[model samples]
Target: MDDVAKGQNLDDFLINLADGLSRAQSRLNRYPVMNAVGQQSMVYHIPRLEFELKLQMTAAETPASSGSGGRLPLQKKSRVQFLPVKASQHQSSSSATSIIKGVFVATPLDATVSQVRLSLSVEKKAARKAQVNVAVIAAPGRSVQGATVELNIDRELSERLNKTPLKPSTRLEQASLILNQESVASAGLIIANQEPEGQIIALIADLFGQTQTLLYRFEQG
Candidate 1:
């Protein structure tokens, strides 16, 4: 689900749960969030709003105009930087390994773009497994509904990662961090054995380029 839709879903969960707040203290413990400072307290109403939005989105058979001129898959312009990959021990060509990481960033989706997808990777020696962390930083004026962000690993890459072995002490990748509206963008790393370093970097570049191309087309339109 897109960030908006997931948020909406979470909102509904909270509201429904809140309805039974008669035993306030009992349920209160269930959600330590309500005890938070200021804005955190407002987390209580999320569930209700999410439920309502879900109903509305579902009832609307036709795509409700987003009230914007963005393309079918709306996306925004954003930049991704791959910080260095520090591995414990570099492997030779004979080894098949893979390393992956998440590069998080915060920026707006071009008025023309609606969806955003990213990929990050590093060289590998032996066949290894890889994973990526994904998130959506909502756009200011746009709405994302049931937005599905998929992590695609081609058959060839998938097979390679599954068979690679891991390097015990190497920090193939770093952990990913999730950021919100007021927070800075960040990412996590999932390094493995199998995928080549050159191949991994190229894949990441390709993912960014593809997103850029989509945004470009939308802007040009």
Candidate 2:
């Protein structure tokens, strides 16, 4: 199908799905039996990603044989992984681009959860066409080997239609996050580290390559 036809079909589907869900929720709320049966709950959306990070720690100590009993102070160090998803849009061969901050973690307890935003200005330089696939490594806070990670791409949440094998022209466009699930957890060796931020960086490195030269700015709110 052509681009216009595809766009129309996608819009219709989304509208119908939203309407159906709304009706179902209303019916469930109005029925006392259904409400008591726990069917009155509404489906909520959370922005999340599946990520993992490998960390190395080190410490310094005094000799055990020292009878002087001098200061036995200790020290520590760590490494981290980071993957940030920002809202983006692309005009059909336009010069300027617009970006809306995408919400990452939205929970009832911490409704004021902080978010990380990124803005990249792509210059008119020659870059080879490449495809990047982001994945999550499940780490459930401990060694439970053989854990798996997944990525979920939501076209509506982040704006812009889904397109695979995107072609880059002179126009700079915004990219959407391909998330793993509503919430992300780590398992196995990764969980042993207990480092959420570090894992995010590692996952991004695996998908987008080295970060030595990548320009990144972190905003907290």
Candidate 3:
């Protein structure tokens, strides 16, 4: 689809999306169930890459480690798994939650949560191609790990990339990375010759019972 049509579709789609979320938020307010999180998930629709970051509350009752609204903490482990599901089969919030099941691991109540900046660079290889470079800068004496990096590309563009042996995709059908001080994550892309849209990348640091979450998005269009 062209840019104009895509924009039109997105506009129309948001109408339903807003209304649905409004209703869902009401239900969530009425029933703050399992997830002991501020926001269970923040969804992005690049026509359904379906990236979901969920915070769930467990009643294990060990200690109040990490929870919102005076809830208890969990002792679960962090897990990352990739599953390929057809868009047609993705129908409900339950299914969406199932998509990215274990996004965050357990954290200690005393562990502090803070925001730190990381470097993201894009070098143009051609009008239709570029290399994405990501760097995580930390305090000279501190340690940082690129726990997770999410990149949102057009759905069709992503599929095309898969056929050409691009880097592995996340459960969100895009890119997820694990980078350390000694390594970085870089990839080249050609989005049908388009200059590429602003990407929505999440940098999660899940070391030492702390979770540093960053949501950054930019689009050329």
Highest lDDT model number: 3
- Candidate 1 on 1-221: residue-level lDDT in tens? 34243344534544554454424432332232322321113212222211111122221122344446755554442222212224554534433333332222324446677444333332223334333334444445644344433232222322343343223322314333333443223233333343334332111111211221010000101
Q: Model 2 lDDT vs. the true structure?
A: 0.26
lDDT of 2 at 102: 26
**lDDT score, residue 129, model 1?**
32
* Candidate 3 colliding pairs: 34-57, 35-56, 35-57, 36-57, 198-218, 198-219
Could you tally the backbone clashes for each prediction?
Answer: 49, 16, 6
- Candidates in descending lDDT order: 3, 1, 2
* Candidate 2 residue-wise lDDT, 140-182, digit = tens: 4323123222222121221221222112231112233333452
Candidates in order: C-alpha RMSD to true structure: 28.7, 30.0, 21.9
How well does model 3 score by local distance difference test? 0.39
Model 2 regions more than 4 Å off:
34-221
Cα lDDT of model 3 by residue, 125-195, tens digit:
65445566666654455455655644333333333323332233322323665666654655564434322
**Candidate 1 regions with alpha-carbon error over 4 angstroms:** 1-127, 153-201, 204-221
Order of the predicted models by TM-score, top scorer first = 3, 1, 2
User: How do the predictions measure up, each by TM-score?
Assistant: 0.20, 0.16, 0.29
